[model samples]
Target: MWQKHNPARELRSLLSRIETVSQPQVGLVADVLEHACPRLKSTLGPNALVRRLIEAEAWVDLGFWLIGWELPDWAVHRLSCDDSRWSCAICVRGLALNWVEDVAEFQHEDPALAILGAFVQAQVRKAQGHGPSNVTIFRRVERSGAVSMGPEVER
Candidate 1:
């Protein structure tokens, strides 16, 4: 007889892969920003805006854990369990990165926050069986950045 498939075990395996990437560090951040933005090639012209947008995106990915989020197929699967047409956190982040053009554009008003908030709210609700719908996931993501800096706050 064939063995039964276990959802939790599958989820664990997926989470492990998502978490295994080395944490984003300063050197890696610099390299990604330089490569994606290419400051030297940009001048005071139309390409300057495009370069700025690319740099902002690279910063968001490195400054946040967007790349790790992107790598996990499981995360996407989990979030879209109810509806196949829905986009997950990773996709939302990519969309946000593309939308953001500069540092000033990186704020709560950004659409990235809205997408992240919805995704996080869904996860929290799934985990707790119930939770506030309006809770912002950016708070948790921002907390992760603080934790990386060695000073974590109590939630």
Candidate 2:
């Protein structure tokens, strides 16, 4: 939609800006994505922008934790139940990853948009890749006193 509707030209007219791919940090990338997600979904459909981002390997570069999922109605049902597969945060994260179609879908491309969509739900909502830097998951929380919820949970 940006390309068709002339995002560059419009930006040039409106803000006199030029696009640059150099030296973009995760915080910078995240700020743009989070704020633009609503408009992106409106303009390109939810999956389209995500698909583009994944194809560009945006997340790998950003090392950002995902948040803010505009979940599908069906997914909301699965995640809402306490007796659900999503009850344990770790378990839910795993479940969401599988649902996202990690492998390539022949017609589409690599990584799959649904996978990114699931990440959109599971990072803070999801976390992927083999890179190590920031981001941490507290795998276990040991309630020190009598307020324990049974045992230490592995996130």
Candidate 3:
């Protein structure tokens, strides 16, 4: 069966491969970044930017650069462990006028890869309309210890 493509799974595989390589090539990383964030299509300097960052071996900076294109407003990353794993968190600005107050997290041994994964995950969720602002979430109430559907609410 031909299954649909899932960006999250693809990101995991890409990051895993990157981890084994001593130095990930610019072309591969750049291609992945472009595929991950299509919004960057409006810009003409991505390739050059990728080359510079890769040459500098600036993984964290690459992550931030990607985030700037995706969620230009705000994003953050943190070192989750001393083993060099990094966790990235981002605020998804939904289609609604107000922010949905949702956060998606992704981790990787390389900070850039971690942020890249988070970017892909967040973008996928947003596109699928996963947040409360985009979809109506069904609530459940307990009646005699039995769960029943309650009013639909927007988180």
Candidate 4:
């Protein structure tokens, strides 16, 4: 039999290859991970791995992210959602540590997230600085492109 080769159907078939498993109590897992280390917080703050751990806890409370992706650092493996094969261990374990070693270092697949994060850092710098009275602060966060007065005078 010759298939019509529908792209949409083919895409759905590929997506189904991902796996999802259910667990009774996952909210406390992040806390356990935190206690496992003394400086987990200062180490991986605002990064992807920490974000996923938070989702694990929220999943128990609001019943989300538990069904689909694990968030931040989840991957498919061997066409199964089995806990033993879950990608968290392989993905998150050393990912954050690498970033800690070098702020510009990122092993994650996506590069756009890194660019967006750099933009946030730029905005933070503008927020707390001394600039000239005539300087204009461009607010890029909004689509309208806001402009506001900067500091009274340059330092």
- Each candidate's TM vs. the true structure? 0.20, 0.19, 0.57, 0.19
Q: What is the C-alpha RMSD of each candidate to the true structure, in Å?
A: 20.8, 17.1, 13.1, 20.5
Q: Which residue pairs show collisions in model 1? A: none
For model 4, the stretches where C-alpha displacement exceeds 4 angstroms are: 1-27, 36-39, 47-155
* Residues 35-142 of candidate 3: C-alpha lDDT, one tens digit per residue: 666766767867688668878978778777877766664455343644667677676444434444466577666666666666666665656566333334457866
| Candidate numbers sorted by TM-score from highest down | 3, 1, 4, 2
lDDT of each: 0.32, 0.32, 0.63, 0.28
Instruction: Give lDDT tens digits, candidate 4, residues 1-155.
Output: 99874533432232222112133234333432332222344555534754664555443222122212222232111122243432121122223444332121111122222222222222222233411122234432423475445434323
Q: Which segments of model 1 are wrong by more than 4 Å?
A: 1-108, 129-155
Order of models, best lDDT first: 3, 1, 2, 4
Quote the RMSD, in angstroms, for model 4. 20.5
What lDDT is obtained when candidate 1 is compared to the true structure?
A: 0.32
Off by over 4 Å in 2: 1-32, 35-57, 61-64, 67-108, 112-114, 121-155
| Backbone clash count, each prediction separately | 0, 6, 0, 0
Residue-level lDDT of model 1, residues 29-143, one tens digit each, is 3433333222223544534543454466543333234223322211222223233232234232222233222001111223333233333333333334332222233322355
List, residue by residue over 1-155, the lDDT tens digit for candidate 2.
33565432332221111122323334434544543244344654556655566568676322222322332111221212233112211123323345444221111121222223233333222123311223233344445553543445555
